[model samples]
Target: MILAQILHSLFFIFVSYVLYLKYNNGVVKPSYIYSIVFCGLLLFVFNYFFKGLSNRLFLFLLMFSLSFVILQFMKKFVNVFGNNEELAKRKQLKVNVLSVQDFVFKKLFIGLICFYQLLLIWVPGIFEKMMENQ
Candidate 1:
């Protein structure tokens, strides 16, 4: 179970890095959906060794495939609200400036994933507690 938790943390950390690279100010190649397929399969295979109808694995799966959704929703949020012009202007014609937003977003989202892996967030001990209550 501890190993599972470690694996979960590492996987999401990698994903957070990937997201940062995807959004960082640069010429990104048009992406392929294969990246998503690859990540999901990788996550499933590592966690498959544990046998359970419901457990932290189920929660992590929701985090990866559902709750997170790669945070693509941020595009709409950024569009409707607006870009961080203060951050944008700070770049000042230099190329390859590090995006503080992407960096923070990486930490924020990935930090939650790691935190939830450790604490289980809203679903903390949910199944185990239910089993005990019976």
Candidate 2:
């Protein structure tokens, strides 16, 4: 189960990284990848440390909210060390932007990443318990 969870988290991180790279015109910045992995590890640790909540619904809600909070902090941390060249490039590229499309795609990717992280942490036990109850 631990190995499965790790693999699942890695898969989401890879997919999210790929999506980010694609949208960023193939700019493979190490910071983005690191931040994504760091966020995933953080999520995994959080899930592991707090797995004893009796209320499954509350656990779900907590993980969902925690993902957003953690992601937001990660974004802020990355932005604090933003590269000057990247900032310049972004300014230049603003004229050729697809804001709405990119915005929607980015949000969808983030949502998937969060959802998968939660699933990785909870799905096995949650489903097993549900099946036993039935």
Candidate with top TM-score is 1
1-134 in candidate 1: lDDT tens per residue?
56555655555555545555555543434443465556556657655655322345545445663445447565456552135566467664322343444455545765565455445423547646855797
Measured on C-alpha atoms, candidate 2 has an lDDT of 0.54
Alpha carbon deviation, residue 75, candidate 1 (Å): 3.3
Which is the leading candidate under lDDT?
A: 2
| Separate clash counts for every candidate | 0, 0
Error at 38, model 1, angstroms:
4.8
Model 1, residue 7: distance off in Å is 1.2
**Residue-wise lDDT of candidate 2 within 23-133, one digit each (tens)?**
556876677667656755665565567553233433443455446446655765664324456545777455334454356445664666567555735566764576479
Which runs in model 2 stand beyond 4 Å of their true positions? 28-98, 117-121, 125-134
